[model samples]
Target: MPDTALPPTIPTAPVTPAILESLRAIVGDKGLIADDQGKQPFVTDWRGSIVGNAAVVVRPANVEEVSKVVKLCHDNGIAIVPQAGNTGLMGGATPWPSHTGIVLSVGRMNKVLNVDPVGYSMTVEAGCVLQTLQETAASHDRFFPLFLGAQGSCMIGGNLSTNAGGVQVLRYGNARNLVMGLEVVLPNGDIWNGLRALKKDNTGYDLKHLFMGAEGTLGIITKAVLKLWPAAKDVATAWLAIRDPQAAIEILSEAHGASEDNVGSCELMSRTCTDMVLRNIPGTQDPLKADTEWFLLLEWTSARPKAEGAEGMAEKMEQFLADQMEAGRVIDAVIAQSEAQARNMWVIRESVAPASRAEGPGLSYDISVSISKVPEFIERGLKAALDILPSIRPYPLGHIGDGNIHFSFMGPKGMDRETLKQYSPAITRAVNDLVTSLDGSISAEHGIGIDKLDELSHYRSRIELDTMRTIKRALDPKNIMNPGKVLRI
Candidate 1:
């Protein structure tokens, strides 16, 4: 696909009793996963995107345990694949085939170590569920602002590894920006205790960042210190039927400027996306019945305000919408009157993935470009893809505020999935070209797992590619940590 040389196959060592015994001793019964029948669930990823064959899937209880297991693996020259939540879209956490390596799942180590509300930070083990962390933060009157559709199942370690961007990324930035520090187990089993919650640490090169989005190749994240914001005391959500993509952008910018930058999320969806969700997902109704071509789901949070005048904020939002209508930017819109209504409106946006699934046999691609160029990218890319596979149905939607669009193409009528996959790469390449031509990234929120492993080498320049390789070699000289991933070592 990228004209990059495929990696020469590495010889796998026979899993001698000594190897299993060593791993078992480090983590005891709870960590080591040797029996395939029992390790079935952990072997594959959430979407069943990629499956790895780890002879054993180990679960360490703490940093000490992780270091111990990693040390043993390093000594044995056994490759290790780190997994968390298994909800990655790019098959990042997918176990390698042939059971050659060990899959180190951090699910068991899910514990909220501490929440220092005074300092506005929380330290959580890598295994902590994302949704649990969000709830725990709320209990302490603080906010852990990482939001994803998979929050209920995905782990924080995976979030950082992928540098996940969610609906709230427009406000809090991606997962990488929200993290303060991390506890990493190095490639050679050395423990780097970097779990510092300091906001300003000018000590040296920010090493935590390397492992944060490294997809477990550079190191294994054991625990982390994540930054928190003031819990949102009030929030408002609205469904706007916009005239066009440019109008959607204008409404968001205007609302953002008027609301004192309190806007949390601003997403745009075509009627096609809405139609798919309504068709597949049950208990869904269109918020607006107008023949609107596009829609925007906007959210705002006034966290610091000490009064219960959110409706006033809502009124401000109404005026913002009126401004859009006056300019003919929006045709119709509705504001949610209650939290239940807010959740209902959110359901429409979240239902996209499930709806796409129900539609069946599609290629999913999430790529990003500049905010101003998103509409262009979508329009041009969609046209190009449909030209290539004229029968394909395009489902282009996502966080337009940040220029990241989850562009999916459903298989055409009577077309089998095998046929759809044949053109998947063509679709990806066409969109990638458009994105790069516009000076944007091929990946936005999701990490380049095995799904985009080859694409990374193609999209990135030779100098950038070599630099990343050098860093990887410097950190993981043996390439035993998540081998055959992310780069062409």
Candidate 2:
């Protein structure tokens, strides 16, 4: 839990009638939602774990409107929380329960401004849904490889803001690598037009990176220029049953070696995660026949189309799996015979989240370590967690290819919600301690929202935390941009 207490009220930013009217004039009546019922959706997080309170919810339609809203709040000394999609796992987008500021939602500004197939880049509004961007790129015979379970609802702005990493990160990289430029609205309501779609720009101090994972503490990102890739014309997906985490890592290396680093995604899942998905999620069945302690969902993609009298990528992947099976590293494997089969195989991987939720309330930790230390960390961390509470069922799973793991655990069956909630803090501490000792991040892909402020402060050094505070203070001197987030300052 967060150590800091919520402020009773924001004394600086009083939500008076005149101030409300001023804000309404900028975004209009429909855009400014003042009723509690109308603001309900924006106040709460997607998981319902964090609930916030806001004086009003403001929807800005364009960059100019966003600037005006920010400027109005800035002049009045009011704090502003910029939100997009509201799909963040960490409480980054949620306002404090006692906060009396406005929630600036960018959902209305979603649009694809331009697509340059020749240049292999696309300019889009920050509020554009990630799935929509993927579809737009597909229409042009190009690919936007930033994909995740929440892509259907998550916005590009939030993706870039969190520097989101998905399964394709092994091949395409995270959101930071995919984005080329950004157009942000500063805290003082000034618009910085830095949206340059160039691959190489040797300029002084790349300012765009400051806000990429800042969680809106520095500025509000309103638009972005994203890099695209050639569409994958041939794809091969497989589900392999592995003996253990060590074997999974070995197979990942073997897959990369066999494919010349063409492997797109190599997802590792624990047996418990697979069982939960199979039981809770409908239409999900185990891809492999024999039971294994660990599983690896592998995929290989290539832009080259299949040609006559030539070996395809799928054939090579099958041959590689056969070789691994012969070596006894793979207990069993199933290669998707068709695209439909491939999608079905992916469904099991994607259903891990919802299925785990349906199983029971659990303590979830998103951490990362060096790729080589993954197996060791998992071994030690799981033992540490079980030692703390033997009844706890650890369900650790995630993008192990890049060392990011969603190490989560649920209480024993039939445990009440209140009892389960009591173990959260202790469980979190044990896992995080192991992660820090391994030189790993407490929050890997997830940004430090209000949820992990104390944890970050504890794990990071004085100089590191001070440098972050210095940057935050310099960019947002007033401290009105997403106040009480990232840094407690």
Residue-by-residue lDDT tens digits, candidate 1, 71-141? 88787778888889988877677755644868888888899998899999999999999999999999999
- Model 1 gets an lDDT of 0.83
lDDT of 2: 0.87
What's every prediction's RMSD, in angstroms?
2.0, 1.5
Q: Tens digit of lDDT per residue, candidate 2, span 316-394?
A: 9989989998888899888899888898788888877778778877778999998888999999999988887799898
- Taking all chains together, each candidate's TM-score versus the true structure is 0.96, 0.97
Worst 10 residues of 2 by lDDT: 2-11
Provide the overall lDDT of each model, using Cα atoms, as 2-decimal numbers. 0.83, 0.87
Q: Mind sharing the TM-score for model 2?
A: 0.97
